[model samples]
Target chain A: MIVQTALLIGLVLFSVLAILLRDLLKSAISLAAASLFLGIIFFRMNAPYAGVFEISVVAGLITVLFILTIALTKAGDEVRESRVVNWVFPLFFIAFIIIDALVMKGLLRKIPALASGAETGTFGDVLWKGRTFDLVGQIAVILAGVFAVLALFRKGDKHD
Target chain B: MIILFVALPLVVAGILPLVGKVSRRVVPDLLANAALLFLLVYAAITGRHLIAGGPVLQQLSWFGEPVAIRLALDGFSLLMLLAIALVGLAACLFSIDYMEHYGAKANYYALFLVMIAGMNGLVLATDLFNVYLFMEVAAVASYALVAFGLGRDELEAAFKYLLLSVVATAFILISVAVIFGMTGSLDFAAVAKALQELNAGAAVGVASAFFLMGFGLKAALIPFHAWLPDAHPSAPAPISAVLSGLLIKVSGVYAMTRIFLNVFGLTPALSTVLMSLGALSMVVAAFLALGQKDMKRMLAYSSISQVGYVVLGIGIGTPLGIAGGLFHLFNHALAKGLLFLTSGSVQQATGTRDLDEMGGLAKRMPITAATNLVGALSIAGVPPLNGFWSKLIIIIALVQSGHPVFAVIAVLTSVLTLWYYLLMQRKAFFGKLNEKWAAVKEAPFWMTAATVFLALLCVGIGILFSSTVTTWIQPAADVLADGVHAVIGSWGF
Candidate 1:
């Protein structure tokens, strides 16, 4: 449990750095890594299916898409816009408020209660018996996604 | 039979390109329209009931436990299906000639049909995950359609749309994951049942925020509307018609309404959030639209504004409000579809989408001019048109619910809606014929036919609204009014 908390803290720190990083590619990779760590935490919490899906879908597929978009757009050189100091004060103020709320909300206490006696069947049991329609819907979404990407990337058509 | 509403479209959409490959030019157009017509007929016959004693459980067993992939049709789904089918048939018919300018007729039809299939699947989906999948299907096709022109602007707009949409999907997926974590169920009925068992708090608040942002983006509400003005106008005219007429409503607004109302139960805070967002989009988009010179761009903004009305009405969470909202949805689809198609016709004849570039086009394209006028007046809430009735109902409901301020805002926005629409009319259609467009003829027979059909339907529905309400609008409203409890009760889970 100590190690898990440490890993989560590390992930949160890395994710903040990632968002502020100079290199887009490095940011993407760092974000993916953070997602991986978060997935691991989910697994430690006994949500193996969600953990796996998180690593595979969010970290793997979406990260690849982001990279492809970055590559396609030729955005290698980072645009370092000057930051507004005024913005930072409010941003940190909001962040502190959120942090305070998080600590006071008893969320940590609730997590263990949720973890106890949670369903432990394979991903199929929850997906089919509990949420089968979502799977079918996801398939439909993937089909649309694939087609849209194909249309954008289609070659040798110069009718514009 | 319920499944066929989705399956028939999927099968036909898949086979359409191949069929087009074999047939003569006219056959593909006829077949596509005929297919939608058949689906429309099928839905009408099936009416509002769930397919009784049908295969309620079809477990593929591939993913592990026998997960039943279910599709159920109810009044709300049926109404939306009918709307998609009706408008889709008209768009397909109009495209027969409009698409002649573009060379890839087969591919265009294929994408169009696939989008229809996705929308059908979305409306009929009883499960939350299925909603995501179907939403993607529609979203992806829309992205491709937006970029179909392959112009620099088209590519730019499509990319922006794709980026924002991906973010929205990610938000929705995360919410779905959280909901599954909370309830251990993905089916809408099952999720609602489980949610009732759990206490509402921060976790649910987080989930609701995810849904709000995700679906809000899809619906193009105020803060999330940056992509819409570009994306909607960038598409080819038929595709624009579809985007404005149906896409945003189905994937964005409809899905949000279904999930929030039927699945998660609309709490006071959420309803307030929806209403405020709706009001913001309505006022802001209308004001922004009033300053635009591009005719289609202005209309695109107007679409966002009108959608605000629908959302606001639904957000009120009264039976009358929901009914009014759904009624407005139907009317907006017709009016907006007609307007977009007519704009396409105008663009084709004049070779520009700029309102400033057009003058006195009414003389040359009389059919388009008349229909565009009808659409404009209808949208602007002129008396006896469909828009006025729906807007009136919404205002009445608002006043009845003791929200006089919102009712006043709704009224004021109707005038604002008129201001931009009239500005659009004066600049594009009402002035003297431009010398450069002296040779411009009316849009071809089919496009004119489609525009006229929708225009007439707009009037017909307005005049015969009482019967239409009794038959269609009331049932759909009842579904939403029944709320989360009725939905779970219906399943007998």
Candidate 2:
């Protein structure tokens, strides 16, 4: 329990750091650290498939992509953020944490356990047979993302 | 097949980019428009027969074994499907001409079709997780479409929209997670059954709250509506039409009501909350719309306000009220869709969205002005238009339900709606000719045709409302009026 709590704390800390850090490289690294912590939590919670995806896809592949993109682009003119956001985000964050801490424990106690057993079958079985509709949706989303990239990147495209 | 509703557009979308290489303009245009026309025919004509007996449940079988892609179409989903196809085809037709100068027409059509597929999938989905997945599908496509112009305002608006939308989805996901934990099911019928057996009010309330915030943001309900006025106006005009006319209704209102009325079963408390939110959104957004100078921005706020009317009518939780809400939804989809398309025409001709910039456009573009007036009056709830009947039904339902104050509010907002719409009409089209717009021509054939299509439907539905309501709205309202029985009894997987 202590180890799990520490890991959860690490996840939140790194996530907050990812948002707060000014340096793009540091922010990317912080996000990676957060994802790693989350992946560990998922594994500890018996969701190894989710853990693997979180670590490999998000913590590894996405981090690399972010670093590569950041490396390729020169920093543009410094953009100043609003003063309101600096304080407001943290304020909301703290308030949410407080509310979660107060409400979640009692709420968790009240929630009756699921009437059914845990998800069964292999990952492929679940993917192919249990949730085939998701695959269609995923395909459409990927198609959307690809088309978006193509449309947005098309050159010399100015206001009509 | 019901699956075709999702698969057809997605299949076409997948081919469009490749097809762009061969013939960017003509082929993509024809293919995309053809796909939408097929959908319209399938929904408006074929859908009725399929659902006449009862809900059509589909489970695709590969070879001999059935896979778990469960989709269902009932009266309510059929109504939504019909609305999506109609507005989707109109927007696609409008895009034929309007997207000419924007370039990369194939890519544009591809995204548009994908968005339509997403919406259709959402309505047809039998499970909760699938609903979330499909909503995201539509959302990602819209973010790109909103920023398709690649201008500073477009990019900025898209970014803000993306941020808020992410927040909305987070709340929704959290609610889904909580519900899953308690019920161990994501299918609508199973969840409804589980929730009824459990009777865990506090947890259910939490889930419902998260859902309300999520969908309210999607619907652009007041207080959660900061992103819409920016995002709607920033997109290209046809996109604006779809965004205002269809996306919010589909993703926001439709999703919310389906979950609330069918899956969760609307309690009096939930009903009260919904009505309060509806009243708030309708009243506040109407007032906000009254002050806008940008033509599309005004329309965007009006979308929010009208959506409020939809929620209010549905919130009454009666057959007549649900019918009123749904009828308003369909009418607003047509009228608002028409208004936005005409706004696009005006923008294209004049190169501005500022209503105060010019006058006397009626002389130059008579059809556009006429269509624009039709849209404005319909939305403003003027007589002999579809909007009038729907609003009246809602008001009457409200009074019968002992919510006279809300009824009064709805009436006053209608007047406010008329006031601003007239202000827009007078400022842009009525007065002395704006010398700068003298050379502007009527919109190209396709654009004019699209506007006319929706405009005529508004008038036709108005005149033939009883028949239209009997054929379309009654079935849908009956299903919703059935409450939990609509799902638990028939939607078993």
Candidate 3:
């Protein structure tokens, strides 16, 4: 529990750092760290499938993509100060605090218990049998990701 | 198996890249077309059985016990599958010629096939989480397809689409998570049954709001519609056709309707909210389309307006209303897809999408001109066209449901739709031939063939309107009207 709390704090700090960092590369790295923390939390919560996906896809693949995008564009060293964000952050922070408090106090109690179905199945059984279509969808999405990358980076088209 | 509807294209999409590496460009094209054709043929063969079979529920199992990955097919999902297969086939055929210049033909076909797979999964998904996942699959593929051209405008539009879509997906995830937390299962039937017993009005209400925001953004309804105009017009024309014609209806309107009507019983308040959004999108988008100079952009705005008519029909929540909505759904797929493809041909032939830059190409590109005219007049609600019947039904439904003002607005919007489409026709096709495009010939044979096929469907469905409603459309409406419990009972889950 202590480790989970520490991981949660690390997630928040890394996320804030990702947003506030001016250097694009550092921001990308911070975002990856945040993803890593999130994956750990998912694992702690007993959702290994979600945690593995979060680590592999978001922390590993997406972070690599972000770093590559930054490097390919030679944008990592460029940093610009944003007066607008400084002005906006406090208001957002306050709003978030208020919503969090309302949820913790009044709104949280309304949540109902989980609805267990009539049948129970193993995790693999649930995924393969109950959610087969989603697996197909995920494969399509991965293929789309590959094609999108190829389309963006491939050369020799006159339309370019 | 019921899973074949989603699995077939997916399996084909997975192999397309490897096949492309070995063969010429046409290989991917032929293979993708074959896959879509197979699905279309399969749908045609089995559609009757599904509708007659009452509800086809196939559960994946382990240890001889039913498992969570279940697929449910009723009349509604069958109609949607048929629509996806048909429109996807037309888009693929059109892309064969149109995508020749885009380069990376194999990659484009891969993305396109993936999109078809996603839509098929989305429509057939029996669980809330699967719907969300399939929606993302379709959404991500479409985002990449939007940016496929890699032009300045395409990238900008894609970035905007991605950002807004992420927001929408975040909302959808929150709602799904909230529901799962409240009702231990993500299965649609289980949640619906559990929700019925729980005194969770406030929670359901908030989730409904999130769903409306999410799906409304997907559908490009009036208030949440900032991204669609730019995104739709910026993609390759076939992608634009698929986006406007099928994606929004399936992911946005269809998913939203299923959730609101079936999972959450459609209360009067929800009905009012949906009807209001529909009316707003219908009238507002038509007015916006009037002043657009770009041909595809104008058609994009018109899609939003036409979608309003569908939403209005569905929001009325009457049998006639849903029937009208479903009819309009299929009609829009045929007609609007035809219009986008025609615009693409015009753009391909003349090298411009600006209506003002295009004039009197009728002589040079007779097939395109004729097909464009068919699409325009059909969309304008001309008598004996499918659009006319659907719009009339929706308006009549509004009146019968005692919302005379909305009915009046519906009639006015139909006229408004006609005014702009006629404006588009006059400016682009009916004028004296632009000397610049005098040398432009009809689009390549395949493009013309695809457009003509959709055009024929527009005309044929209109002519055979009653038969279509009875066989294809009405059963879908009956499924919606029967509510969640009846559907669940039919599945015997």
Task: List DockQ for all candidates.
Answer: 0.31, 0.66, 0.55
Q: Which regions in candidate 3 have their CA more than 4 angstroms from the true location?
A: A1-17, A36-78, A103-106, A114-132, A158-160, B61-68
TM-score of each: 0.87, 0.97, 0.93
User: Which 10 consecutive residues of model 1 chain B have the lowest summed lDDT?
Assistant: B51-60
Candidate 3: tens digits of C-alpha lDDT, residues B1-493: 8778877787787788788778747799899999999999888787677658687788776688765667888888888888898888988999999998888887888888888888888888888988998998888889989998889999999999999888888888999988988888777888888888899998898899999999999999989999999999999999999999999999899999889888888889999999999999999999999999999999999999999989999999999998999889989988999999999999999888999998888888888989998899888899898888988888888889999999999899889889999888888888799889878988998899999999999889889999989989998899888777655566556
Model 2 ranges off by over 4 Å: A74-94, A157-160
Q: State the lDDT of candidate 2 residue by residue for B1-493, as single tens digits.
A: 8999999999999999999999978999999999999999999999999999999999899998999999999999999999999999999999999999999999999999999999999999999999999999999999999999999999999999999999999999999998998998999999999999997999999999999999999999988999999999999999999999999999999999999999899999999998999999999999999999999999999999999999999999999999999999999999999999999999999999999996889999999999999999999999899999999999999999999999999999999999999999999899999899889999999999999999999999999999999999999999999998999999997
Interface RMSD of each: 3.9, 2.0, 2.6
Model 3 clash pairs are: A114-B184, A115-B183, A115-B184, A129-B69, A130-B68, A130-B69, A131-B69
Q: In model 1, which regions exceed 4 Å deviation?
A: A5-39, A47-112, A115-120, A123-135, A154-160, B20-27, B48-67
Give the candidate order by descending DockQ: 2, 3, 1
Q: After best superposition, candidate 2 residue B455: deviation in angstroms?
A: 0.5
lDDT of 1 at B455: 93
Predicted model with the maximum TM-score: 2
Error of 1 at A141 (Å): 3.5
lDDT-superior candidate, 2 or 3: 2
True lDDT of residue B382, candidate 1: 97
